[model samples]
Target chain A: MKYHGGHFICAVWKLDIRLWQLLIMASLLLAGVWFRDFSLYPAQIAFTFAAGLITQAIFLRLFKLEQHGFLSATITCFGLCLLLRSSALWVHPAVASLVMASKFLIRPQGAHLFNPANLGVVLGLSFFPETWVTSGQWGQDLTTALWLIAAGFFIARNAKRLDITAYFLLFYASLFLVIRVAWYGYTLPVFFHQFQNGALLLFAFFMISDPMTIPRHHKARILHAAVVAVLAYIWQYQLYWNQGIIWGLFWATFLVPLWNHLFPAPRYQWQALSGEHT
Target chain B: MTTRLIFLLLALSISQTSQAFCGFYVAKADASLYNQASQVVMTRKDDKTVLSLMNDYQGELKDFALVVPVPQVLTEGQIHIGDAKLFKHIDDFSAPRLVEYHDEDPCQPPVMYEKMMSAPMPTAAMPQKAKSDKSLGVTVEAEYTVGEYDIVILSAKESDGLEKWLQASGYKIPKGASAALKPYIKQNLKFFVAKVNLKEQNKTGLKFLRPLQFAFESPKFMLPIRLGMINAKGPQDLLVYILTEKGRVESSNYQTLKLPSNMDIPVYIKDNFADFYKALFETQVKKQNLRAVFTEYFWNMGWCDPCASEPLSYEELKQLGVFWLNQNSNAPQVMSGGGVPVQVTRLHVRYTPDSFPEDLSFQETRDTENFQGRYVLRHAWQGKPEQCEAAKTYFEQLAKRHEQEAKTLAELTGWELSDIKKKMNLNDAPDQESTDQWWKKIW
Candidate 1:
């Protein structure tokens, strides 16, 4: 029954990673709103969090789920705030509520089927005409890019999800390089310009690399990254669709169940592994 | 005196009283505020786009030529000569506006001010064959004489061959144009080469070039700015007026930022609004390192809150390539009886070759939020001491407000604070008697 020093340290480490993610997300939102002049209103952000947390509480109560906490909801709220834009006040909260509800409702084999933020954005865009994401809102600036990459490395390292992030960036960047530089004969700066987008970096590190929603096995994860990258490239370059990354990830989500079935691995638990990389 | 040919489009004023509580429009800061600014009006609905290109090319008529990259070879029917007046209407409607509001009487109900200050306006070629050999790898896909333009649509097999073909035909293209043309050629985009047809020009009897418009259906909603930048002197200004059915159109690759708007500056700006906007824009471009596309105005064509110019009429909107307007006669209206809802997003970009390497690509967002680069000038209440306490207190607050406005102008234009204060005639320095009293006490 005695608690050991290692046990105390492990408990602290588990909370530390979530704290880091929260801090990074909050700072990025602040930078975006303050310096980048994001078209998000204060009331929209407040309502989004209220709707996300309230819906999460309601779903927890109705489902009689025991593991009820604010950490996951907080992460989802930040993600929504970072990506979703709406002139109307209702869209953010409405989308946030649906996203939080999906975590409980859309359960497949006791795991959330889709990333909560990603689902919310895709659905919001499809259903509401007023809601859209501005991918170019975060233009490629050297200072901001370095800042995001540095912070993203810390979060990815702590989460042990760097494999997916690395693979996703590699695949996406190589395609851009080929199209902009080699085939088109554009200068190297054009290639760098496309790759340095902050939205792409944010997507690579934060949204698509969500641990719980991704495939459980490493091989499945790599495949998932490659497929999403290819689809995103085609969507943006070939089909000329906006929000290609979001669309790619949304379509790629259905493959998770198949991937997990083929290559089974232990289910990821936030508490079981500390900030230590596996 | 050398004869200066100035073609003026008669300004048609459509006066309609606005019901919205937004301030009344006093003056406009149009693309004319910038020198060498090229105006392009692009109306897109889904995959269909109609682009109207107008430039102030004041050189010899024979030397005037424009070569643009088209997604497909445009037929003669796709090309039309647009009325220069339509550009004026859209520009007058969506140009960054200066609106005035009179400060109410401190002792009585408010009265809005009506005085306005007006500002001064700021005020491609071809290929040859020759090496007309079929083996030169250049194919002229289509050729036509539309309006006063001799148009040739070319699809090239290689950049070198295309450059050689252009040179052989006496199109005087810039030296580095081949490198710029390679990417568009690789993308299979046809080159739209146009030069003035002297015979047609003489028949038109107009000194200025009429805007050239082309309607095309392609999945790509982009403007090829790279080809234009090849021989650019220093920096070029492009005023892109985009009209979409749903919402705002924004640059996909570059940051699309709404210019600083809805700020109250000094009333003196009403007289010098042109100079103020020019300096303000220059400062913003420098601050962003000249790497941003600035949205000067985005509003529904149905109505304007402050009627900068009257909302373009249904006929005018149709002329600007709003093909969806006829189909959706019942499109959602922002204002009752204000015409069909067509969103106009006026984007102004000042780009150097270094700042912008790629052609500007755009996407129409579903955000229907209305925004405009509107600056306000509030005329202070001129009440006497015979009035009530409110009047007395208003003067005290007015001084502070004036100081704040001066600071804002300085910060926005990168002007010296001292110089702005001097210009503002901020003479509220500590009284000589008060200073002497303090000195007397010390002595």
Candidate 2:
């Protein structure tokens, strides 16, 4: 069937990538909860989304800003539910609210400064005594890993930001290989085992590859990804900190404005891309 | 009135004793129960680590030698032979316990289980030698005798040199040990080699070798499990008792699994707790492909639920390398559940060299949640049948519960379901119920 011009272009290009993101994230959540014994309760998940959405709504009304959508808030909630673990139920919603509020409260240049999920996790771990991130929750399972990579690639492709994911994974994996195999005299399988991690893959495909939070310019984004990868490797292997990807991303967000200033490009608009194929 | 008051006081004392226990402790599975198991007590705060390696070597004292990778050269003051009782204390305190709870009378007003308490029963539970040469690129950093062992700290340039030096010094180094030594050597880690000094051993008047304890400062919070795996016969069991200031210590490299706990099992398990525990562990190890670090227990060092034994005294903890216990001047003499500074996380791993390639890297999580590999054995009420319907219902449910317990045991130990049913004697009631039940085989 033949389609109309602009509508078809919109359908093909700017098809609310958040919709795909939500679907992917929801599937991941379901898979984690069902298959992996990911130490999450249904009530905790419900409370997290409720708290995040309510906080986002309140902030939008208070600031008198045009309510873009709850899509971003939903994504952030899913990310929090997927990552953060606590013995107490209240930590989930409390961290969710603070993370959502930060998105509105700590706007550096009319843009959300930190990735809400990353900020919430880092802050939750640092501030609260009970909260933690279970990096080994996703054990080295080949089938689950391949599925995540495929799904992540599809989502990134839809967002038209696969380059960042590709670059981050490449740099991060290569650095791990170098350290383990070249420097440490470990076997080749040890280098490959690092790639089979579900946490690292999730961070690369979902967290670090967030199109909105990363640098706008392509070159700046590449540089930003590389910097985060290096910092994460250092934070993990050198400083021996947990949630290295999160801490690295949290620190690297400070440099986004610098990268923006150095290599200025049009701010990424969710609805700007139209399928007038390049 | 005076007699009544005296009776009340007597009752109060009895109730206090009952309430003190979380459950009726029946049996325990400690480190001493397992063959070929090595226990290591690691007291870590910041970069400072005090590791006490418990030697379970049962062979001739002369043949026993230990080679461990250390981050720095340990001086004579840094190395000491620790009291063996420290391990026994920690092991008894943290062992996976079997707790029994007796059922209450169904007709009576719901009284606490403590009121109907029954008496709890107690249940019973590496090498090196070295010679140095400049051509072999082996350097002996320090040499000393600590207690019954002669200790030497060696730093090597290559694996071959390390192997040759050890062989020349009359230490029986395992084949392929050189390959294992290479990684640690390349990382610039020094080796702590200990051999039994027969003259010193005779002086101690002890039949068993004492645990070797050493202190060091390093950025790496890891146990070099790879070196231990070099010449392991089958899979080796390593029980790590990590004493940290904050929270749980889990393997960063491999998955750290909390052993399945708090489930009711066949009451017969109380008699065979050791066998049951071995089977349960073997089943889980098989399920995880022998690649998981199972957390047998994690709790505040001061207290326990259904405690297998008493909490270690401050002096005992200090003897076990807990240096920070005295930091808080106002710490309590009698330890309880909460407000204890030191957290004990016990991790058990049945790992082979192939399954675990890297050394066990650890990260102390902020999760202060208490966990233990505790099994429950609910003792059914031995009372006779009464005219009341409640008693009848109770008996019926008890049978069903017994069947469930049998099934749970079957799942846990991979025992035959029929065999467990026979052992539990839950066959007659369940069979009758199954025949009459409408939902049974309806599909």
Candidate 3:
């Protein structure tokens, strides 16, 4: 198979990629239905599906996410779904849909100005005074942490950003240790829960590993990821303000281009010396 | 370089060691009581003496004496000795001597010694009685010193009391003798022992012609006796009964009394004196009774103002019908919106235009008018003509009641109706004509 833009389907029309992405998204939807034990009423199911699809379509179109291709659309949709699920605590489904729709207004370009998930959570919390609720469980519950970790590892490997991932983990661990010592005198159970919970695992693998947003050089990428992880860990566990991962990812994306310009690695040179005609 | 490093280390160690014991110190003295004409001797640990002589008493200590340990200097104003701070002036001294001391010296601390010395003296001899009789009490004489004054207490028997006392005595008790005798009697009386300023008087001898009976009286019995003396001139021979149990003067029935030459009688017993007595008596009675009162009322009538309305009942609240609904049921939900019932748990009401007998009615009308006006304005701005028309009908009835209440309040308070109109800022009365005109313009 021939490749365009490092993807086998990149040469295909943009609409075809979108259609393929939608099929994958539908399969995810079916998985949710199959996994959930409580049978949703047909009307409820229809409403839920329609709300998700309309919100996803409206925000994507408004933000011009199509220009970024199927990958961007898929990542944005996945992030939006996870955020909406989390925000279901305080707001009605329709209101959550409306909140998700507001992403287009806040987005600067085809990509989000802030992390869409973090912005959605903050906007929902502030705008709807009566019904701002939090989804207490991340993924499904504590049990899903292992699956998330495995998925993160798989994603990191495929992105060929192992050094960057390792650096991120190391930097995060150090920051966590420092803050834990300062706050609780040692690393606490709550600190581990904070690391496992929310968009942290997903963000490390998906957002930080974005090839277009991060630096291309291995060393630069390592530094970039490490900085992001440290900042994110500080914001979440140390500062105790929500949406640290989003801010970390946003800042790390900006820093990648700057790091590439400032710290370029020396070019490889091999010396060829001829023995004097022996 | 190594020598310099060693020197630096030595310097650091010296500084650190010296820093521990360095603290501020204060020296204090009371100059007023201290005789500046005499020399001051200060003893030190080395048995060496620092002397401040009479000539060293300049108005400011800084002018004459040297402040030792040059960096630490003495302040010139008033100095504190122990807890007491004495001024520089000589006459202000009440103590016999002044002591000087430093606060920081842990060993051989401060010391004080008396500046003046005196010996205790014996009492003066008492005069022997000339005669003794059974009717009067035993004759005795005593003398005591009070500061510089001498006082004597003398008692004579009845046989030597009247005529012999007149002959033997150089001074005769005044003719209507009760006046002169009153103070002497009061002094000797046992009832006055606790209350009088006997201990304060600097006296040596008390001479009594007769031993006055000392009977203790309660405060209740004494109060009236005190009041009688306060009212009357000179001293009256009054028959006073004292309440034995409660310490009060029961009565003072005054007879004819002679006036002293210097005394102003009427001005001394003014109306204020009577008022003071009456006030004291009334306060006592009120305290005995322990009477006080408090009352509160709560009521709910039909209609009221928005801000000052009674709480709505649960059934009444159900009419709004908004509920909190959780949208994402799958996630651990923290909040929700939709039809969640809210029940009114408390009620409070406040009324104004208080003088108007129909204050509740008046407030209701005013509140209704204001509410309707706001509603109409909002609907009109929203382009909801139907709602605005409905609100207009509600406003018409409100305007009538407001006018009636305004007229009633004006008449009751004797205020001009025009003043009421001005205060309300009404362009014209809220009659049918104005209402029709207002509607036409708005529509």
Candidate 4:
């Protein structure tokens, strides 16, 4: 039991959950490009990764922050590749750099202000004429939707932020049910159709539940999730706009500082994710 | 070689027979490919939208029924009957094209390239009805006779009352339609009901009903298509021509996929391009499981590379409900890139009731990149395979290319590989006895 070789193996076994996150995100992107016919080109995706990682390197060096790592930035790169679409080549790298820079530059307190990829997409959709989000890029196919939900659940749990995802989805689904089915008289399938969306699930588990951005207090996080849900609903149904969830998260970001101030909780550390040793 | 003029025949889905260039251009695949296909042209800018709906109703004129839920009650000036030729032109312009380019002589450098386009298909549909009465919770907002048709606009408080009013007015209402109409009614949408008036129809002396168009202002950028699925027997084909100011229009809810395009196919497909296209589309829809909308074409109004049909003129564009075109006399030459900036997006969907649970919603993006469903055919030079070293090498590569083309055709259409090989006549090539054969060197 005291063998040095055994100790080495155990250390390797306790690899960071961020590596698992990178793996899951990479697989989802690959599956979308190959089977789902995502319009993302390989060169564009490479540019995204290059821009994200390079920016992360620059920021880490600028602050000389040895504790920060490339894993989170790389994850944001995958998020950008999965959500953002553009005919022009430059939009991807530009968006990735802006969002990665946000991680370091946009800190409100000790935590980053917005989920990098979510804010990147919102800014791209707002500012860039060539860029757009293919919210329906992943069709409402059962296999893809199930894979997203299952993968999202895994990561949300490992990151200790499953509460936000669960609450956000619950609140959003109930809103759809009440307005679309009960009030508007749409059938149940119409309501369920929205659930099968890959974009919505991706936002719930990945964007809204971003542990670094959401409220640190448990109760505050739940309230944050519901606020995002209602804002997203209003953006989509009332305004008849696209990228509702993305904008929803972007607008909800302003309240995070207030939530953290009111409901104080201990600061989060990457090592906390190792509690379950996933 | 410098002066040789090798005529390239472009079916343009253009020439049904005569591959004549510098002459007449006809569309290849018209909307007659399907049984019950309905075509709609929607041109919108800001809050103003003009929608034109085309129906090929072969049934008894009295039984032809169309009830569309609209955002506002359309006035008489808002309604107009349009020429069917406009639909034909737009369909031809956006149809998936089969372009054929002949290879230059192996001994000489290449020069010429030609391209052309084709048609639209049909789908299944049922009927809808409505009326206006205070007691029945239906208000007759307006009535009009735009062309050879009687039109009525009715605002209703409930779906059942609207259905009853239509039924009593002798309109054919499909069963369970009230359920489908409920959502639109609750959304406060008024109904635009139209039926053919046989007496006025005889005066026009046209065999088919002209397309119906209406212009209105609304924030909703959507097509009320779910109501048409009330009594749908099976999946139906819908061709939507969306003209916008800045960029392309895509479904906000459903996946907007582009058909696999721009590949080389066997020259034999030239004879049966229509059937080839049908197979290509059917196979793609099967792959998507009828769950996605396909973008057949998206291009600016300025020009076409190899025009499938002559670009729609400004007058014709206006007739097709492009309200944004300026009244300047110079705008008539929109083909010169000087007219009002309009981009057309042709979206095709083979939709079933189960796959499409809700009405389609759309959004316009600021992307002007042009795309089309383009297929290519490469014809070999007529030079002798033994004419020169280049000729022999060309012949060798040609045989291999044909083999690959056969495989591609099978993959695209989900056809039998063996059958494609048989059709390609891959057995009797002269390359079999070429001097480069390894057996000759051994001897």
Off by over 4 Å in 1: A1-16, A271-278, B1-24, B109-132, B327-339, B429-443
Predicted candidate 1 versus true structure: per-residue lDDT over B237-264, tens digit per residue: 9999999887888899999999888888
Q: List the residue pairs that clash in candidate 1.
A: B32-B122, B65-B124, B66-B124, B102-B113, B127-B166, B128-B165, B128-B166, B128-B169, B129-B132
lDDT of 2 by residue, A1-278 (tens): 34567676656565577777788899989998887777687878987887788888878888896656798899999999999987666778778888988988787666888988999898888886567888877777777789889988877876778899998888888887788677767887676566777888888888987877889899999999999999999998778777788898989999998998899887776632342322
lDDT by residue (A1-278, candidate 4, tens digit) is 23266766656546777777788899999999998888778878987887778778878889999667788899999999999988777677778988988888888887789899988888888898567888888899988889888998988897888999999999989998999899889999988788899998888888887788889999999999899999999999888877888888899999999999999998765632436433
DockQ of each: 0.47, 0.34, 0.00, 0.38
In model 3, the Cα lDDT at residue B30 comes to: 24
Give the per-residue lDDT digits (tens) of candidate 3, residues B1-443. 42453244234311111111111111111222222222111111111112111122233211111111100111211111110110111111111111112222222234553322211000112212223333444232333332222223344323235323422422222343232223323323211100111333224232211111111211111111221122123322211111111011100111011111111111111323233222322332232221110000111111111112222222221111111213333221221221122211110111111111110000000000001000000011122224555445445544554455445434333446676556545446455555568667877
Candidate 4 local distance difference test against the native: 0.81
The residue-level lDDT of candidate 3 at B199 comes to: 33
Any runs in candidate 4 off by more than 4 Å, and if so which?
A: A1-13, A276-278, B1-27, B109-131, B332-340, B429-443
Q: What's model 4's TM-score?
A: 0.90
Ten residues in sequence with the least summed lDDT for candidate 3 chain B: B359-368
Which tens-of-lDDT digit does each residue in B1-443 have in candidate 2?
42453244234211111134446787899987778888999999999999999888877777777888999998899998899899998998999999888788877878644443221200001243445688999998998988998888999999899988888887777787787788789888999888888899999999999999999999899998877776676988999999998888888877778888889998988889999999999999998888788899987776666778877777777877788776455442333435468889999999887788778888888777778888998888777668476888989888778878988999999999999888887666557556678987686
Preferred candidate (lDDT higher): 3 or 4? 4
True contacts kept of 2: 0.45
Alpha-carbon local distance difference test for all models: 0.82, 0.81, 0.32, 0.81
- Each prediction's TM-score versus the true structure: 0.90, 0.90, 0.29, 0.90
- Tell me the number of clashing residue pairs for each predicted model: 9, 2, 38, 14
Docking class of 2: acceptable
